[model samples]
Target chain A: MNQDSLAYLPASKLARLLASGELTSVELSRSVLERAEHLNAQVNAFLGWDGEDLMAQAEASDKRRKADKALGFFDGIPVALKNNIAVKGSLLTCGSRMLENFVSPYDATVVERMKAAGMLVWGRLNMDEFAMGSSTETSYFGSTANPWDLTRTPGGSSGGSAAALAAGMSPITLGSDTGGSIRQPAAFCGIYGLKPTYGRVSRYGLVAFASSLDQIGPFGHCVEDVARMMEVLCGVDPKDSSSYPAPVSPFHAELELALTGGRPMVLGLPVEYFKEDGLDPAVRRAMDEVVAYYKGIGWQIKDVSLPNSHLAVPTYYVIATAEASSNLARFDGIRYTHRSESASDAVDVYFKSRGEGFGEEVKRRIILGTFVLSSGYHDAYYLKAQLVRTLIRNDFSKAFGEVDLVLTPTTPSPAFVRGERITDPLQMYLNDIYTICPNLTGLPAISVPCGFASQNLPVGFQLIAPHFEEVRLLTAARAYEKGNDWHTRHPAL
Target chain B: MEHIDIGYTAKLARLELSKDEQELYSAQLGRILEYFHVLSSVDTSGVEPTAHANPLHNVLREDVAVPGFGAGPALANAPQQREDQVLVPRVIE
Candidate 1:
C-alpha cells in the first residue's frame, strides 16, 4: 500500500495486515511518526513524541508476532493518548504551565491495558489547559489547527487527539470527555468519537475535570475501530471506585452483528435541537440529509422532546467549574512542578504559583468554581446546578423509554476559525451546547461524520444511547457509517 | 442577582490577580454568572441533588497493600525536593 493510504487505514484493516505478515509494527509506526513529524509544525497536534520508546514497543510487538504469541488485535496498532491520561515516564502536561515539567511515575489503568494488548503508545497530544476550554486556544503549548483548514480550530480539550486522527498521525487515540471534550472535537474534525457511559472505562489515570461527569473514551476514523478499542478499554478496575462492575459486552462481535442485522432501527430527533434560530444553516442541512438518508434506508425517525436541553450549557459550567476548583487544588507549588520564583511564605507561594502557572481561562474557571462553591453561594449555584442536572438526566431517561437512541447535531456548527470564539468565553462555552447534555445524563454518545458544509468543513451526527449501551450506539453509528463516505475522507495537507 | 466581588473571589481561589486580569475576569465572570441566573427559573425546590449520574455505591477493595512507586519516583515531579520529601516554602520561620 502507498504510504499515504497506509497512514490513514483503519486500525482493523491495519491489524489484519499485521496478522498476515503483510506489514510489520515497526514499519507502521515509522510511517505514522514520519507523517506526524512532517505535520507537527503546522498542526501542533502532539505535545510530546518519544520516537525511541515507540520504536522499541513496535519491535516488541513484531517480536511477539514472530513468536506466534501475539497479545491481542491491537498488538501492533499505533495509539495516541490525550496528555491528561498518564503514561509512565512521560511528561503528562495537561497543556498547562503548572505541570509543564511534571513526569508521570505510573501508567494510567488504560495505558496499562493498552500496553498489555501490545499497542505501540508514545505520543502525548495537546489539549486545553486542564481540559477546561472548548477551542484548545487555552493550551499553553499553542492552539492545534484544524487539518482541513489551517486557519480554523480543531475544536478542543481533546482537539489535538481529534486532529491527530484526522491527520492520520495515529490509527486510534484515547481522549477524556467532560462536557463534550471528546465528541465536540470529533465532530469538528469529522471523525468518530465516543463518550462512553460514565464509569464504563476506568478513570484511574485520566486527570479529573468533573468527577461526576468525566469519562475517557476513544476517537477513531470508523465505528468498528472505536468498538475494537472499547473491547480493550472497558472493564471494571479496582483502582477507580466509580468504574462499573458489570461485565463488558463483546463490542466487536456485537458491532459485526449490528451491521448485518435486518431489523429497522428507531432513532429519536429531539425537537429542541432542531430549532431554526441560531442553528447553522449547513449543520441544519446536514441533519436534514442524515434524517432523510436514514428514513430512505428503512429506519424509523421520530421527534422527541428533551425539554431541559436549553439549560445544559449553564448547568455544565456551574458543576464543571465547581469541581475544577476543588480538583485543581492539588496543583499547589509544593507538590508539582512550576513553583514561582518569588515567594516568601507558604500562602504567598500558593497565590503566586497558581497565579503564574495557570493561564487566563484556567484562572477564570478557578474563580468561577470558587465563587459557586463558596459558603453562601453553594446552595444557590452548586446545589441548584446539581438538581438541574437530575432534571437533565430525567429528560434523557424519558426519551430513551420511547426511543432506542436519540440523535442530534454533534456541534451547533462546523469548526470555527482559530480566533473566532476564543475572545468570548460565553461563546466558547456555548460550543458545547449540544454535546454537554450527554455528559450530564451519563449517556453513551458517539459523533459520526455524516456530511460536509459549504466550506468543505465536516458535520457530524450524534447518536446517544442509554448507559452502558455502547454496543447499540456503535452498531447504530456503523449502520450510518457503512452507507456514508464522510468518515473515510481525510484532509489534504 | 448578586454582583460578584472579583477581588474577594480571587483571594478565595488563592489566585493573585493583577489589575488588568482582575478587571477582565471580573467583567467576563460577571457576564457568565449573570447568565447562570436562568437556572433559577427552574423549580428544583424538592429535587435531591445528584452528585453522580450512576448509582454504584461503596466500591471498596481489600485492605491488602500493593507495592507502590518508591520515594524516588514519588518525588520526581516536585518543583523543589529535599531528601525523600518535597521542599516547600517555610511554613514557620
Candidate 2:
C-alpha cells in the first residue's frame, strides 16, 4: 500500500502492517498528519495538532518495532483523543470557547494508557460544548459538516471523532458519551462507535458533563478495532474511582465469540421506542430489515417493554444539566482561564465571561438546571426526575432478564441537513431519543451501520446490552455486520 | 394557572437575551416545563428516587500522592503561567 492508503487502513490493519515491517510508524503517522491538514478544511475533524511531537513519537515506535521491543497491539497506530480527554501539553478545549486556548498540563488516565500501549496521539477532535449537545452544531468552534454531504451534520459531541474516522483522517478515536454523543454521531457519520457500560472505562481527566452518565470509549472503522482499543483503555484506573475494578476481559478474543444456531442470543424491541409521529420510513425500513437479518441467523426476537421510557429524555436533561451546572462552575475567571475584558469587578467577570463564552444552547441548559435545583424547586422537578429515572432503570433490568440484548434505530430519523433543525431546539433534542435513555440507564450500547438512507447517508442499527455485557453486544454486532457490507460502504471521499 | 418569569430566568442564567430572545425562550421553555408539570401530577408515593446507577456509595481512594506531571511541563502550555500554577487577569470581586 502507498503512503496515502495508510490513511485508509483501520487500526487493526495498521497494526498488522506495522508489525510485519511493510510500513513503519513514521509512514503511518506522517500519512495521517498530511491527510488531516489537507482534508480538515472539508470536515474540520480536529481542534489541534502536534506535527513534530507526533513524528517524534512515531519514530520512537519505529525504533521499538525494529528492536523487537514494543507495547501491545496498538503500538504504531495514529489516533485522536476527543478534546475532553486531556493529553499533556495539548489544547483540550472540548469544543467550547470558554477553554479555547486552555491547554492541559497532564495526561488523562485514558491518554496515559494509550501512550503506554504505543498509540501516537495525533491531536484533539471538536465536540459540543462540554459534551452537552446532540449535534456538533452547538460547538463554539463551528459545526463539523458530514463527510457524506457537506450540507448536513456529522452527529455530535463526538462528531469530529466519527468524521475523522469516516474521512479516513484517523483510524481510531476516544469519545465520551454522556447522552449518546458517541453513538449518535457515529451513526450519522457512518462509522462504528460504542458507549461501553458507564464504568467500563475510566473517566479520569474527562472534563465532567454528567459524572454518572459520562463514559469514555473508542470509535473505530470495525468491531474488532473497537475491541482492540478497549482492551488497552478499559481496565480499572485508581485515578477514576468509578472505573470497574475487575480485570479487563479478553475483549479481542471475545470478538471471535460466534453467533451459532438456535437463539444464541435474544433480541428485544421496545415498541414505545419507535412510536413517534415523525418517524422516517427509511429508518423504520432499516430496523425491519435488521430484525429479519437477526431472525434469519436464528436469533429469537420479542417485543419488550420499558414503560417509563417516555420520561427518559426529560430525566436525562435534568440530571445531566444539573451535574453540568455544578461541574462547570469551577471554570470561573478566578481559575486562571478565560476572563472578560470589560469586567470592573470579580463577580462581573465571572458572570460575564461565562455568559459570553458559553453558546446559546449551553446557556439555556445552565439556566434550566439552576432553576430545577434552586432552593424551592428541587423537590418538584429534580426529585421527580430522579424518581422517574429509577422507573426507567427498573424497566430495563426486567427486560434484560427476559432477553440478552435489544435492538433499536440509533436515531429517530437520519442525519438532518445542516441548519435544518438548529432553529428548533425541541426537534433537535428529539434526534437522540433512541440513544439517550441507554445513557440514563448506564447500559452498554453501540451504533453499527445497517443500511443507507438518502444522499448516500448511512443508517446505524443500535444494540443495547446489560451493563458490562459489551462482549455479547460486540459478538452480536459483528454477526450483523458480517451478514452485510454495511461497514464497508464508506462515504465517497 | 401559574407561570415563570423570563426576567428571573435570564438573571439566573447570567445571560442577556434580548426582549425578543426572552420571549422566544420563555415560550419554548414554557411548553417544555408544561410537559414536565404533567409528569409531576402522576403519583409516586411508593417510588424510591435513585440518584446514581452504581448503587451510590462513598468510594474512597488512598490519599498518597502518586507522581504527577512535572510542574515545568505541566505549566508549559498554560496560556498564562506563574509559580508552578496558572495565572489570569485580575478577576474583580
Candidate 3:
C-alpha cells in the first residue's frame, strides 16, 4: 500500500498486518512519524514527538511478536495522547505555560495499560490551556487547525487528538473529556471519539481539570478501533479510587457480536436538543438523516424530553470552575510548575506566578470559579449549580427508561472558523452545548461521522448509553458505521 | 447579583490581573453571571447536591507500606530545590 493508504488504515487492520508478518512495527511507526512531521506545520496537531523513543517501543513489540509472546491483538499499534495525560519522563504540559517545561516522573494508569497491551506511545498532542477552552486557540503553544478546513478550528480542548487521527498522523489516540472536550473535537474532525461513563476509566496522573466530570477516552477512525482500545483501557486502578471496580469488557469481541446482530435498539431524540434556534441547518439536516436511517433499519425512534439540559452549560461552568479553583491550587509556583522571577515575597509568588503562567481563558475560569466558591456566594452559585446538576442527571435517567440509548447531534455545527468565537467566552462555551449533557449525567457517549456539512466539513451525531454500558454504545455506533462510508472518507491533505 | 469585583475575585484566586484584563474580565464576567441567573428559575427545593457522578465515596485502600517516588524524582520538577528540599520564598520573614 502507498503511504496515504497505509497511514490511514484503522488500528484493527494494522493489527492484522502485524500479526500476519505482513508489516513491521518500526516501518509503521516511522511512516506515521514522517507523515506527522510533514503535516505538523500545517495542522499543528502534535506538541512534539520523540521518533527514537517510539521506534524503540515499536521494536520491543516486534521482539515480543518474534518470541510468540506478543502482548495482544493491538500490539505494535501507535497511540497518541493529549498533552494532559502523563507518561513518565515525557513533557506533561496541559497546553499551559504553568507546565510548559515540566516533565512527569510516573506514567498514568492508562499509559501503563497501553504499554502492557504493547501499543506504542507516540506524540504529545496539543490542547486548550489547562483544558479550559472549546477551541484549541486557547492553547499556549498554538491552535490546531481542522484538517478539513485549515482556516477553521479542530474543536477542543482535545483538538490535537482529533486532528491527528483525521490527518492520519496517528491511527488511534486518547483524550480527556470534561464537558465535551473529546466528543466535540471528534465531531469537528470527523472521527469516532468515545467518552466512557464517568469512573469507567481511571484519572490517576491525568492533570485534573474537573475531577468529577473528567474522563479519559479513545479516538479513532472506526468504531472497532475505539472498542479495541477500550479492552485494555477499562478496569479498576488501585491508585484512582474513583475508577470503577468492574471487570474489563471484551470490547472487540462485543463489537463483532454487535455488528452481526439486528438493530434492536430504541434511540431517543431529546426534543430540547433539537431546537431550531442555534443549531446550524447543515447539522440539523445531518441529524435528521441519521434518525431516518435508524428508523429505516428497523430500529425504534422516540422523541424524549430532557427538560433540565438547558441548565447544563451554566451548571457546568459553576461546578467546573469551582473544582478548578481548588484543583489548581496545588500549582503555587513552589512545586513542579512555573515560578515567576519577579516574586519578592512568598505570597507574591502565587499572584505573579499564576498570572504569568495561565492564559486568558484559564484566568477567566479561575476567577469565575473562585467567585462562585467564595464566601456568601457558595450556596447561591456553586452549591446551587450542584443541586441543579442533580436535576439534569435526573432528566437523563428519566429518558433512558423510555429508550435504549439517546442520539443527538454531537455539536451545534461543523468546524467553526478559528477566531470566530474565541473573543466571546459564552459563544465558545455553547459549542459544547449538545455534548456536555452526557458528561453531566455520567453517561457513555460516542461521536461518529454522520455526514458532511457545507464546505465539506464533517459533522457527527452522538449516541449515549446508560452508565457502564459501553458495549451497547460501541455496538450501536458500529452498526451506524457498517451502513455508511463516512468513517472511510479522509480530508484532502 | 451585582457585578463581580474583578480585583477581589482575582485576589481570592491568587492571580494578578493586568488593568486590561481586569476591565475585560469585569465586563465578560458580568455577562456570564447574568446568564447564570437562569439557574434560579429551577425549583431545586430539597434536592440533594450530586458532588460526584458515581456514588463511590471515601474509598479506603489497605494501609500498607509501599514504595513511593523517592525524593530525587519527587523534587525533580520543583522550580527551586536544595538537596532533597523544595525551596520557597521564606514565609516567616
Question: Interface RMSD (Å), each candidate?
Answer: 1.0, 2.8, 0.9
Q: Give per-residue CA lDDT, model 1, range A1-493, as digits (tens).
A: 5558797899999999999999999999989888889898999999979998899999999999999999999898989999999988899999999999988888999999998999988899989999999878899999999999989999988999999999998999989999889999999999999999988999998888889999999999888799999989998999999999777987988877876874878999999888837689999999999999889888999999999888888999999999999999888888876899998798898999999999999999999999999989998899999999999998888998888999999999999999888889998998888899888888989999988997789999899999888888988888888788988889998
* Per-prediction DockQ: 0.84, 0.44, 0.87
Worst 10 residues of 2 chain A by lDDT: A254-263
True contacts kept of 1: 0.86
Model with the higher DockQ, candidate 1 or 3: 3
Candidate 1 per-residue lDDT over residues B1-93, each given as its tens digit: 467788998898888899999999878888998899999889987788888888798877779999998989888888888889988877877
Question: CA RMSD for every model?
Answer: 1.1, 2.3, 1.1
Tens digit of lDDT per residue, candidate 2, span A60-114? 9999989999888889888898889888777888788888878787788888888
Model 1 ranges off by over 4 Å = none
True contacts kept of each: 0.86, 0.36, 0.89
Ranking by DockQ: 3, 1, 2
lDDT score at residue A1, model 3, on the 0-100 scale: 57
Model 2 lDDT vs. the true structure? 0.82
Q: Please give each candidate's TM-score.
A: 0.98, 0.95, 0.99
